[model samples]
Target: MKKKFILLSGLATSLLLSGCWDINEAQRMYYVDGLGIDYKDGQYEIYLQLINFTNVAKSEYPNPQTVPAEVGQAKGKTLEEALFKLFRSIDQKVFWGHMTFIIFSEEALKDKNALSIIDTVLRYRETRYQIWTYCTQDSIKDILLLTPILNKSLISSKLSTPLDTDDQETFVEPVNFRNLVIGLNEPNHEIGIPYVTINKNWETAEQQGQDTTFIGVGVLSKSGFKGLIKNDAARGMQWMHNRTHRGEITFKLDGDETDFLTVTLEKIKVDIEPLVKNNQVTFEVVVKLNATLNGLKTNVSEDEIRKKIIKEVKKEIRTTYKEALAKDIDIYRLSEHLYRKNVKVWKRLEKDGKIPLTPSSISKLEIDVNQVNSGRKTFTGTFND
Candidate 1:
């Protein structure tokens, strides 16, 4: 009976000690939603965007106004040091498990130690591999300070959510931490990250709003910060890289500046073939597109419009390829493709150290456009009529 009494007493004590021992109250923790990294003057600057649950959870009706998140900054010689310095100013333990996105300043990427910063982030236990990554030429602090205009969620949501969520599709593909790491580890060490900028417009004296806009893509080579590809060039890279989904294209009809045609992309398929002969390499790119007419101001049939689109897509692809080659930016990832398909040739080239291949090495490029649906038209007028 004494042994039984002792066992019961010990069980009670253990239960009391184990219950919620490490549990922190919700009010005592800061949930970081976004992280921004910048480098200047041999120092690393860290920016943390913390979501305010209290403000986000408000139940008020009729235009409730409350800031959803707040930003904090700190600087040090290393990433860890910067983060620790940031923690010094906050009373609550910063939780990073909920982080949705990360932004790196262009200046940070220009630094030779940019990859080291990424390695540091991967080492953290709380950091996630799937977090979206972006690069911006603007101030990292300003990017983090952007507040959501029409949405109630945090401003960082714009960068975190998939680009296809909106009605209009994005040109550049989204890159995550895992993809960035993989690219950096590739033989060529080339990668492209989506670029973001602020769109500031003053509407009225009482109301001035600023929103975040994805401008284009920033390319990174082994040397770092190659350049930026925007608009048509970015779209062209997406096609060659087979990263395009659904996006709208606007072009002039019959080379007339006033007559415009806008088409919505339905599907795209790209085939890249790498051929090796006598220690020389050449690539052939074939692009197939399925699209529909969204709007037309030209007096041409659907067949004619299809031909125009095919030509335009081919032009875009060639222009982008040439530009990348001139700048020594391998956005098409031709070397990676060769390594995957023709291993022996790629290894031989790598052993030789610095393969002498140019953009002109792409000998052939063909584009085939198919109009799946022309849509119903209220007015039927043809140039032949």
Candidate 2:
């Protein structure tokens, strides 16, 4: 009787384990790694970066014709409408579970209702909040279509590189939807996403057999792109966020001579102090950095190089900070300073303006950079040439 009871219990357990509740197979649908959204004229345009599985599988085998990816686009009155239209045109079911990027076109950001569109993406149950987000000075569609000729795998496989994230070396940092939402909800902070611009030579892109090409950055204020920020301005944005990891800077050594050096930042800290007196809003931004000299093409004394780096870094920081102030972007958390230091004034300021940023309020900018080490002299690995 005991053996019979045991058999019945085993049968019951097996019956409960039968099927998938929300199972999805990779083969059944096409994986989307990047998405671009743009608003032009009167419609919303959606671009999807689709991965080719067969070519990706054949990447190990040498074949030049195996292009890594393809692009698809569609337009509609609403975001979902445009997306569904794009899905219907594609041969396979579009799956965004593996998606890593989202790029917004300048036009899309122009909408006063831009935040509403953002709300749609975040509110979706299937959308992953951790995916990297960017803005493009050019059309979002063009940026999504960029695939290098040598890219044998596909767009989906290529975006995994760490370069996309903001480090000391890069001016742009990969800001995701989650970070944006968090900043928006915070009492005294603003958000900025990295920007991209399309490479001009499309025929060359096709002839060269590459998938996509882009450059520069898209700047955002409140609802949309305020304008495009390039070169030093972008660098300033990185400094404001205190996100520099590994960056290169050129310093003037002597007359008509300049030396290039790369530094890997070890630590960064920023403090914002705001004061209101004599009916004037005064802001003091202080930034501190500890860095290692990682690269140097021209040899120089350690002491000399250290001095040059500090001087150049100070100039760069001041210049960039000024640019941020000009744009009133507040890449640094100046609003947070006001809230923490003087809550009553911040409340009054908020009640006065829809866009709560002011350029004239800045009174001082101070930057300090300390050189830690000049990296190791000997490489651990053997180089066979």
Residue-pair clashes, model 2: 17
lDDT for each residue of candidate 1 in 20-121, tens digit (9 for 90 to 100) = 778888788898888999888899888998977675454232134666678999999988899888888898888888787999998888888888888888
Extract clashing residue pairs from model 1.
none
Q: Per-candidate TM vs. native?
A: 0.89, 0.76
Model 1 spans with C-alpha error above 4 angstroms? 1-17, 55-63, 164-167, 201-206, 351-355, 378-385
Clashes of 1: 0
C-alpha positional error of residue 114 in candidate 1 after TM-score superposition, expressed in Å: 0.4
Per-model lDDT: 0.76, 0.64
**Cα lDDT of model 2 by residue, 62-141, tens digit:** 25665456778889889989888877778767776767778787778877767878888778776788877777666565
State residue 313's C-alpha deviation in candidate 2, in Å: 3.0
Model 1 vs truth, CA RMSD: 3.2
